[model samples]
Target: MQGHRPSQKQLYDHFAPKMLGVCYRYARTLQEAEDFLQEAFITVFRKLDQYRNEGPLGKWIYRIVINTCINGIRARCRFSDTAGRIDVEHLENESTAHPAAHSEIIELVRQLPTVYMTVFNLHAVEGYPHEDIAKMLDTNVNTVRSQYSRARTLLMKKLGSGPKTNENGKRG
Candidate 1:
């Protein structure tokens, strides 16, 4: 299938669900996630030619979706920052835990502050290293590390558990 090209509808049909799952991880609301998914699919189709076929198509599309989500978050942050600042402490202190039988973990993750959530998802979910995440977010590696630490702490607190330790007795 070297010379083969899937139609846009075919690509959308195959990838939309998976890509929407990725978007939902970053977005705070379902509507926002849907918007990001639509925008990402638009970008994927526009940049389809840049995919060199050296790797699986899904990986390539996943990268694009991640970039699109990051960009959307950045843009939203910029707009919100310009308008006014949010009391992150208040938001964090609010009751975030919900008694949902399913999607409780995802709901907990969504309650995290944007920076912490982004770092946590990138590191723990996407399996990106701190150094790579630093580059991707245009911040220092130490900052990413700090954010990841805080994210883990918050998550553990919300989950009503102590932090997990590795075999070496360091925080996992």
Candidate 2:
């Protein structure tokens, strides 16, 4: 996962069982969980490496069976409604909100600490693999993964709460 790329079958064989357990955690049904696996595979195959194997969906579906396995977390992040903001509190007051607040979300992304913003952008926005981001940052893959995870956690925390300092780290 970190160095040389592996084949899709190889990836599937190695990680499918574990990931299916994850997919089953929040998905409505077994089939839905399988669908999540496929979707997760397709997403990672297309976004992470962009390589193709000429099997099934062809070469574009290569190795990347790890990081994107947790789809439930991203989809189930709870948020409180706040006008022009996403907060982590339970709001007693309901305010009118636009359907898509792209700017507000972008602002939150921008407000991430430098490392988080950089890793988040590189991985989520730029579609780089964690290894690639690690290489770019001169660090190990776990560190990159940790930063990205923390970034997502922070963003989820701020979904309706607006930016708040991470008690465990530098201000973001």
TM-score (C-alpha) between model 1 and the true structure: 0.77
lDDT of 2 at 21: 60
Question: How would you encode candidate 1's per-residue C-alpha lDDT over 1-172 as one tens digit per residue?
Answer: 2233567778888999989999999999989999999999888877777889999999999998998888888887631111001222323444354335237666877897887788778987899999998888888888887887777777766765646678895877
Tens-digit lDDT string for candidate 2 (1-172):
4233567567777767866665543344578668777887767645644444445432233223223423332354322121112232222122225435555655666676555655665677557899986765567888777777777777766764535567784557
Q: What is the C-alpha lDDT of each candidate?
A: 0.76, 0.55
Go through the candidates in order and give the C-alpha RMSD of each one to the true structure.
Answer: 9.3, 14.7
- For each candidate in turn, the TM-score is 0.77, 0.38
Worst 10 residues of 2 by lDDT: 79-88
Instruction: Name every residue pair that clashes in candidate 1.
Output: none
Off by over 4 Å in 1: 1-6, 78-102, 163-172
Best lDDT goes to which candidate?
A: 1
Off by over 4 Å in 2: 1-100, 161-172
